[model samples]
Target: MFRNIVVGLSGGVDSAVAALLLKRKGFNVTAVFLRNWDTADETGKCLADEDYKDAEYISKKINIPLVEVNFVKEYWHEVFTYLLESYEGGYTPNPDIMCNKNIKFKKFYNFARENLKADAIATGHYARSSFGPYLEDYKPGAKVKLLHAVNQKKDQTFFLSQVSQESLQRCMFPLGEMMKTDVKKLAVEAGLGVIAQKPESMGICFIGTRTFQNFIPQYLENKPGNFINYETGEVVGQHQGIHCWTLGQGCRIAGSSEKLFVLRKDIKTNDIFVVPGTDHPALFSRILITSKPHWICEEPESLIDSWTVLNCEYRFQRNEKLCPCRVYKSSNNKLIIVSEKEKRAISPGQFVVLYLNDECLGSAPITHAGPSLHSLGEGEITSDVDDNDGLLRASTV
Candidate 1:
């Protein structure tokens, strides 16, 4: 029921169907082609030509104006730079979360509101939004409440945890209530051109399918190191570089029949220790310590005597569940989960989101463990508490 809306058009079926849905709702929708990268490899066709053409065709079919916003510089400076630094510093990074935070929501949101004069910005993200009944003690004019998307498999709320409450108020996600299959069916039914069968892009940030190592060499000089066994400090393998491998990787140890997983990294000694078991018990823990907490709910007035219960998700696609937590800022502000039944692979640089039932309470950066992927710069080891605990965490290199 809103007019003057700006929808991000990715030249894919999801955004294409989103534009159609907004049009059906009688909104003055304008599609914008966000130029996220500049891959100029001539042989690889590493450019945005096809995507631009698709956007043009879709815009024409939808009878809406199409705009282009170039964000290549921001992607490089903010997201890619951090990714490179995190690797060199010996920690895994999530560029996708950074992309959502700095690019899609922050920069893109500003452009739509200020330059395009849009009343609201919409995307094809699989998350829902609604206005909640205001509480007597609640702050006035708090109209935004984020909810999980209908298609549970495709839910993306984890990446969106960083979105400010102010931005969430003006943001809209039309595909949240609908399943991916339904969106595809609508695209075909609406007679959208070639994009009706376009495949979803699962490529890494800017560089696409190329290994992070390939791209890292362009920005960093490699430092080779020794790969040692956990029990004995005997050298069993040698790595091209310590930064090339990520924590939790089950890489084959050369010259040994025993498969080894990275357990610890000693940057000072340039040693990468490998453990023996794929299901090593020492790998999992049940306690988590997080820092830099971002609360979407009412900010707790100091951590004093605050014993509150909340639900948390360590990764997207995780079901929300109850966990007893307390915020303690007496020394380095952090959220401590005291009563989680399961140990999780709380990766050092990933996010830890808190929820109340389905509504997001807040989120924090995972700083320490209760079962997590432990990385000591040169190596990593994953641990899970009993097999039945519901804390959601995913392993990524």
Candidate 2:
């Protein structure tokens, strides 16, 4: 059994219960509250102070030592800047994924080991990792296997795919095998009533309850652009900035009763193309080309050789159906994925995580996507423009 442990206390019922469980298991557990983002919302309110207070209260209730660490500078440099740059370059980047890779796992792991003298670090994330036989050598302790949580509704493997193997090997997920309902029950039983009833946070970590459009302009200079109809190449309306919209998002296009959806953005021309309907052919694609892939364990040859059939899930949410696909290698060492069924809104800058059964293999950042030859029609609009400017950076994994 692990002797010394440090758990990230996020001031939520999940982490509160996690701390309780670890203490009960006879481990010397310490709780650390990470102040990652210190920015204020549009209303000039900061949520980090409230969260820190809750974390402190929970630590006293659970009779454990609590420490506070500020990672605002690290978050701004490693995660927030990347997020703004990706939007400016016309791609929707996931900052949560970046936060997990750079701060929670990388920076926090180092702090736990060096300062706290911890043998293992844990979190309330709804994902599991365990020592298992190597994928290549079949040797014990050769690899750490990442698996979905038992509560499928709360799986977080997608956000954690980019975390380094060294961090995962010493990591513990105390709530991985339990359901959310049970976690709340345990929190209440342990006298953590305030945490058990707190609502879960949504949207960007720093933005809190503010509108995304209002918050983004603070960092990125808005470049107004023309909204063009994808079918006829006619100017339908004008947008304040391309950064305000993302592909597949519904927008109120001028002079159209039917809702319009963003199909593509041409950064070079400063134009955003829109289609009439949500089911437009231009919005769906079967082929997705991505940056270099990051495999959690060993690189699977099946992805390069043979047909390499696999199942993919773009969004990490529960109840999302997996899309069957085959992986191939492009000439430039990028991954070319062909889905058996047409996938709607295969947005660039989003992650495409691959899985075999329950084990998460790895993921890659999508760079380009288009309809398969069979799905392409004569009148359908397609963006031939190259959008690889922002994707040239190395994978953070």
Best by lDDT: 2
Measured on C-alpha atoms, candidate 2 has an lDDT of: 0.78
lDDT of 2 by residue, 272-382 (tens): 999888887778765677888888876776555533434454432224676666666544668767566667777778888877778877788988775522245643433
Off by over 4 Å in 1: 41-43, 132-140, 300-331, 338-345, 370-397
358: Cα error in model 2, Å: 0.8
Highest TM-score model number = 2
Model 1 Cα shift for residue 222 (angstroms): 1.3
What C-alpha lDDT, on a 0 to 100 scale, does residue 57 get in candidate 1?
89
Per-prediction TM-score, please?
0.83, 0.90
The alpha-carbon lDDT assigned to residue 11 of candidate 1 equals 87
Worst 10 residues of 2 by lDDT: 388-397
